[model samples]
Target: MTSTATHLTLNRTGDKQPISGFGLWKVPKESAADTVVNVLKAGYRLLDNAADYGNEKEVGDGIVRAIKEGVVKREEIFVTSKLWNTNHAKEHVRPAFERTLKDLQCDYLDLYLIHFPISLKYVDPAVRYPPEWYYDGKGPNCTLENITIRETWEAMEELVDSGLVKNIGISNFNAALIQDLLKYARIKPAVLQIEHHPYLVQQDLIDYVQKNDIAVTGYSSFGAQSYIELGVDHAIKCPPLVQHDVITAISKKHNVTPAQVLLRWATQRNIAVIPKSNNPERLASNRDVFSFNLSADEIKSISALENGHRFNDPGFFFDIPIYA
Candidate 1:
């Protein structure tokens, strides 16, 4: 078997693999045809889009074009999509993934995720609460009465059996929720995608995932640099990774850019990373990770930058009782 996954490694999720290339959530939704093609040409074998990104069609087009030009084989690409917040109902899970596949024009997903552990009412693409926020207690939106996290987990497990998704994972889930899921989950979550960076290293959570033998994936590894346009101005300015004395010295020492150091920091720690870059040149730089290795002490210096802040906090959606 060629191993349908693009990233060349596996974790204990029974059958899960990581994809490197690019994560395309924050890119301008109406990116030009040439822009996407350029990204693929730059060597990003993964395209991370979601039903919520509202740009799966564009991503799919890029993939088709890249294949047409012989940039890479369809199997050589690792395509991942996520079920939106509104479609967390057990019955709605597969249907939602189907829509994503339809838009992305793919036969099956390398990996599919529940998007978040919290569920809410099924909101459509054209809605005010675009992110799928809702207050109903008994619906997908309300974590109170309608659909519970465990219910959503069971549905995700069903997807794997159906073959719509190669593997399943969770995003934005905390340690407590992850621990609780282990008690009832028929299939353990293969990956826990969380926001990580020098500013928010999340040591305890990473340790727990490793102990459970789950492959961990890091998102937003550059902290708020990517979020500046998404209303994270604070993350945009505070404690810039480029300004870090250690990062600067290392960049000069290795004659590499600071962003490369940032990405390598996570990979060196044995965690998966999905950094997004729409710029063709930057995309190439991002995937240039395997070219250089970071030293042990330098990795520690960068890893020590955790200040206990979380970027993609979902407190407005699901309220875990542990906070009490």
Candidate 2:
């Protein structure tokens, strides 16, 4: 309950989060509960789900029908989810986080990541729930589980000591595995989630995890449009940050919408963006990206369209480079 002006204060549970949310990746578990009740009636109080996005029980039946039609208020919706890569075993991380908190009809979980510092082989959600990257799901081959990110960050610090997870993070991690997961993290990882846009601007791994207070979140902010909708020939030969010509000339000098100038160049650098859209007017213009403010030379000409490019690579579909 601390970070209000559009939120993002998390580091040991001063939880606030929603710096522009709503991304249940490739949303289409039969229209994911009416696209999570149309992005929570187009206001989106942070959703960002996973369990490898096989649609967590239709995004928890659209957050229980947008909280029985009051349209919000499951504690004002800040939910987030993850923990896949075959549940990175230390006794399969609390039964894959209680089967993603019983498929997201959550009793508690404001955030919970660890979705991929890669650790496969352990498929049995009754034989493949979201055991995605193949151990035997008929793949180009993948099965590598020696499990030790300090035994899955001490079982995600025992789901923040079993209050059923208020926070616990890491996703497609870097910065030397978050500096070797903060030298054996007991709980120090409130958020990191990457694959950020502007063609992979790792900005020194987002300035070394915001110089250690963590909280970063950026997912495919609209680069290669969700891996060119998964046909992924290097995301169909890259170059489509909403049709980049310096992001449509700074989205035509800020009238907005080169996907809101690549989500206001990563929320004008405070980072946090979720960016999904099943098009209810581009899902309220991708959560109205904090109503604009991108200067500093248009966020350095869109972070100078940095080309280190990365379209959610699992080493290009299971060759397992894990960012080499």
Candidate 3:
């Protein structure tokens, strides 16, 4: 079931990234391997993963099985992973990447990203891997490291120099930080991944990065779906994108699911999307977004749903308010 999905050409390496990919954010380690295999069989070539996901090992197992069974070749898949916030210091960057590469069982990553701009104190992998938010893995207290982005980015460039990562980019970065990064970045960022749904359009940031030739990848395309499972108040209180009147109307008009309409709303505008689902039917529908086109008025109607709402703010769960 190979897909004729659209591709976005990256900057330095000219690598073509799939416009629609599978995100492995909250996937449990127990089911990660099976899920990865299924998605690959369903025609997902781009796998968006991270050390923070705590399921890379299982995800890698799936990839290995998929390749061994001839579901898809390694080169046919564009594997992407991220550097966790705890591994932002210069000395920790390569070692952290090495661990991820080992876990994924890959020689090199198609795209590697600094998961977030916020730097946290390093937690040894032996102490606790994928150290999320809290320094000790148990607390209301979170510590910040003094490491600058420039230092971490320099180390990222070294990964490129070593030919381990084909392209390096940032996630959850704003325009100002991007401007600063460009001033000193020897290897320009090839992509920018952000929480972009109709509720959080972020059109200005998208326009700015796209103008610079940095492709954009949108995660959480369904808005409140992922966060509602985590008991987030903002997400719980917000309207479900799949059920929203506008989305439903558009979906009916296009004869597609609301999920497909939401994804198409982004991909139609040239922004990439990483949407995950365990249901086999939904998986195929999600990747089939490029088949239809939304009218100019429908796109505007979807964008009109923006209310500056953001569901993935670290501030909501931790002391660090990166968005604030």
Q: Which has the greatest TM-score? A: 3
For residue 297, model 1's alpha carbon misses the true position, in angstroms, by 0.6
The runs of at least 3 residues in candidate 3 whose Cα sits more than 4 Å from the true structure, single-residue gaps closed, are 1-5
Per-residue CA lDDT of model 3 for 214-278, tens digit only, reads 99999999999999978888899988999999999999998999999998888878888999987
What's the candidate order when arranged by decreasing TM-score? 3, 1, 2
Pick by TM-score: 1 or 2, better one: 1
Give residue 164's error in model 3 in angstroms. Answer: 0.7
lDDT of 3: 0.92
lDDT per residue as tens, model 1, 179-258? 89999998887777788898889888888987887777788877877656666546656777767888889988888889
TM-scores of all models?
Answer: 0.87, 0.32, 0.97
> Each prediction's Cα RMSD?
4.5, 18.1, 2.5
Off by over 4 Å in 2: 1-32, 36-58, 62-80, 83-92, 104-148, 153-169, 172-174, 178-192, 195-200, 203-217, 220-250, 253-256, 260-274, 277-279, 284-300, 305-324
Clashing pairs counted in every model? 7, 0, 0
